[model samples]
Target: MKKIFGIVVVSLFFLSSQVNAQHKIRIACIGNSITYGATLPNPEKDSYPGQLQNMLGDGYEVMNFGVSGKTVIRNGDNSYVSTKKYEEALQSNPDIVTIKLGTNDSRLPYRLKLDSNFIDDYKALIHSFQQLPSKPKVILLLPVSSFLKDSERQTDEVIVNQVIPKIRQVAYEEKLEMIDLHSITADKESLFPDKLHPSVLGETILAKRIYESVVSKKKMDFDIFSKIKEEKKNSSFYGYDCVDFIFKGRNCKVVKPRFSASGLPWVWRARFFGIEPQADIALLDRGFHLVYCDVAELFGNQEAIDCWNAFYEKMHGAGLSKKVCLEGFSRGGIYVYRWAVTNPKKVACIYADAPVLDLKSWPGGKGKSKGSQEVWEIFKKDFGLSSEEAAMDFKGNPIDLVPQIVKAGFPMLHVVGDADDVVPVDENTKIFEERVKALGGNIMVIHKQDVKHHPHSLKNPQPIVDFILHSVKF
Candidate 1:
């Protein structure tokens, strides 16, 4: 009788995963624990994926195929039958497949030994998804945060630390769309009453995360002034539970496949979102800041003005905020060089990737100037410094600013490639790293021995993210 009942239940769950025949956007929930939400009062209404399907509106069908204790390599049954489930998902011909697995595999921050072991398997799964006749888009959910020790608190520590890293490595390798669902989950209070399965509310938050990643499109910066009108919060960066720190300046921000830590809540900042944290840990966890201005030094261009104003207004209204982290890629690094010199006291750290710091070494303007006409125009217009005196303002030059950097001092993550064509990896990062290191400063360099150009991000992204996180306090 139990076997018959189990078969009937599996049949219903399987049927629920299939689309409603007319076909809108078909999504698949392929994981465990949170996907099933057996701990919720009502599994149908409470499972994260189930709630996701509901919140996603009338145009979507989501199939939840999460088997608790299932890992990517093997679900402890030591069989590749889980691949069959994916095959079934492919047969359904869904437009997208969202994977939230790996929490079971890592369970703690450092259980995995070799990168290839777990990463290769994850790559295999991606390849398997690609093998689908429909060729659905694959979006990986960066694993959520776990307890500090993972002892009596959670069972998914391995996914949070070890497996998720490998998965990210694979995402970069495969070029799949990814979201920061894990970070959102981590920042959120407990979703489980027993410290494991998600409550019904937790399901809603997770589902909304997947929906926003696949469906929504938002500009980099959203409205900040309006939110301040809506929520009566205190402090410059709101320090409440379940707030996304990175969204402090921007209003409608969306992190389409999030990058890493704290990237989750950020993913849904532009769209309607939710964060269901556990009751006990709600107040204990210090939430993420509302706004963070990365590379405010690059605030010279018309491109940088709007973002600066938004951040400035928020900081002004809130009184004072944390030191901003300065991040710049390619020529934008030159802006970092300038911002750092003028306001070193306000900056927390520097992240320079292929920055063009010197006009003499590698002249500026992104392929705009036929000669130096555009250059002189920028010097006169953008700097607002008299052309005659601009030359003497040698202090703002990134190359010249090394002395100030040494004196003011901040940690830096320098990533450059030996064969970069766009920014002449040699002139930009090589010399900058050398000069900065010569002074007393903390700098970490990821020099790709043979790789070329911007492609270096595909190699190691965590180091980039680590630099961003390290720039913050509390």
Candidate 2:
């Protein structure tokens, strides 16, 4: 009886193992020659699918169903749907399907049919995968760049201008994730000796990119850091590399760390950048990217908010953290507070140094401090306030948004000098602190003894650093 019971237990253990093996996440890679690793030294081992399988470990089964010279359009010269590999892929019962079939379609014969048939055929193919018994999550991949000069064949011009746009349209219509392989590989022409197929190194890059997209819960399309070398003017910020670029005619700067922290966290400095370098430098040492966009004269108006909104979209698309730390100094405080109030959820935390909570308090000089009349006129124009009465009645200050700010639930930190005459602490930070505390909001204040607006930030910066790191949960 004991021998029989032991045999039953062993048999059950084997059955469980078999079930686990059968349940591995099956991935079907559908593409053309690029996906098949045509130019790689060893296609079987160095192909993107093989490398992806290794990266995914024992929990995933990645199968390469790529057939060379295949087009996504059904009426094209060589349609992927007509291939036996397509039939095999349909039978694989995959949980995930990655479709990357537009390289050969850029050829003249196939390119002609793309205008009418590309979107329809692509949707049909995606639908076929979606209807399978396993109901796989389908991901579309924009074809990699082809440096070949042959106009009649796969050319970078057609791929970028025509093919990639269609893929993006299809992905948008289908509501599926799309990875931008073309942009990722466009500058890596050296990896493609033949100008068409990626070598082993290129395949490795493709594999890693696909792996990142597959594993990430967020919808990451491309790595923005990859384009910094090609698109921006490089310089140095403190000790780190800084890249300057223009977006929508606005000057922008990004200071990158030697290594990025997890989730690619960043600090968005509103104005007066580099005024107080302590916290920025400390955060950089801890792997935080510092970024700035020039909305200086706009003064947190609708135009400034619109510019920030567009800039935020670009930054988020480039794979920065969804939430960002906002840093503001003096008049720059207006920009940060206005933007944060408008987009509360997008903020991780806020750090204001001798910040201007109320424009009326500083620029209007309606309170204890003597405000700037010249800047006040400009501020009024920017905000569309025609008279002093309009400026006085304006209820758009940060102090007015305490309830909304508190409800957004992001923490705040303020550094101020008791002797500040330019932007008095009593009329700004103190009032803001009282209102925020009354509303049960989280905020911290650091008072500088005998310090004025001449200098900003903390001497040690450890306290400010701790506040930021803790808020971002780094």
Candidate 2 TM-score to native: 0.54
Q: Candidates' TM-scores?
A: 0.45, 0.54
User: For candidate 2, lDDT tens digit of each residue in 334-387?
Assistant: 899889989998999999999999988988898998999998899889989998
- The segments of candidate 1 whose C-alpha lies over 4 angstroms from its true place after superposition are 1-20, 75-84, 108-116, 148-157, 218-474
Which ten contiguous residues of candidate 2 have the minimum total lDDT? Answer: 216-225
* Cα error of candidate 1 at position 207, Å: 1.7
Q: What 10-residue stretch in candidate 1 is worst by lDDT?
A: 263-272
The residue-by-residue lDDT of candidate 1 on 318-421, one tens digit each, is 43334655555555566665656656666667766655666533344233222244554554455555664564354455676788776777777766776666
Q: Model 2: how far is 244 from its true place, Å?
A: 29
Alpha-carbon lDDT, every model: 0.54, 0.85
Error of 1 at 427 (Å): 38
Cα error of candidate 2 at position 353, Å: 23
